[model samples]
Target: MKNLAESVNIEAAEIMKIFQWKGTTDQLTDEEKTHLKYEIADTLIYLFYMCDQLKIDPVDVMKAKLEYNKGRHWKKDKE
Candidate 1:
């Protein structure tokens, strides 16, 4: 497997190709989906790096956000 930086570069190129070939955003081909998978993976890799730099745990942050959202949607007994 390639390193995160390498993946990011690959993803960037694929993104450009996506825009160039599939001008219309309404639909995408199988090739586009493949490109998108790489893009998402690249984004996640970058996000993890950022989290590391900031001294934050991505897993914890995600868990906190999920818990917060769950509480927000919870109904009160009085309702």
Candidate 2:
């Protein structure tokens, strides 16, 4: 299996391509959707590696961030 950093880098590159190809209508081509999946996977791979390096658990961090954001109750204000 490929290592985490390599996987993340590969996915990050795909994300760049997606940005380059995005449509104005908020619709995505099938290939773009597939690339998006890879982009998310790549980000997760990097997050996991960073957590491991810091001796942290991914789930714990995720839960903590979720709780923090929930408490903040962020929303977009309409103009």
Candidate 3:
């Protein structure tokens, strides 16, 4: 479980490289775009694996969370 969570975060960080966070770089190259695709897939794969390993129903959890969020009052702060 811990490994999967770590993998998900690592892959997300890898994907973030394409976006030039904190003025680090320019746009993604063709190769970096390809890497972005793979990283996103990796994140999802780890997430699915973790859910299966925990015997958790992702669909149900997602729905429940969505419903719960729908009932909550919220606002996005101005940037």
Which candidate has the highest TM-score of all?
A: 3
Q: What Cα-based lDDT does every candidate model obtain?
A: 0.73, 0.76, 0.83
Which 10 consecutive positions of candidate 1 have the poorest summed lDDT?
1-10
TM-score of each: 0.56, 0.64, 0.70
Candidate with more favorable, higher TM-score: 1 or 2: 2
- What order do candidates take by TM-score, descending? 3, 2, 1
Error of 1 at 72 (Å): 2.7
Q: What lDDT tens digits, residue by residue, belong to model 1 across residues 1-79? A: 2465665576677667766755464687787788788787777877677677678899999999998887574567448
The alpha-carbon lDDT assigned to residue 60 of candidate 1 equals 98
Error of 2 at 12 (Å): 5.2
Model 3 lowest lDDT segment of ten: 20-29
Q: Which residue pairs come into collision in candidate 1? A: none
What is the model-wide C-alpha lDDT for candidate 3?
0.83
State the lDDT of candidate 2 residue by residue for 10-62, as single tens digits: 77777877878556777787987987897888788786886788799989888
Candidate 2 deviant stretches above 4 angstroms:
1-17, 20-24, 73-79
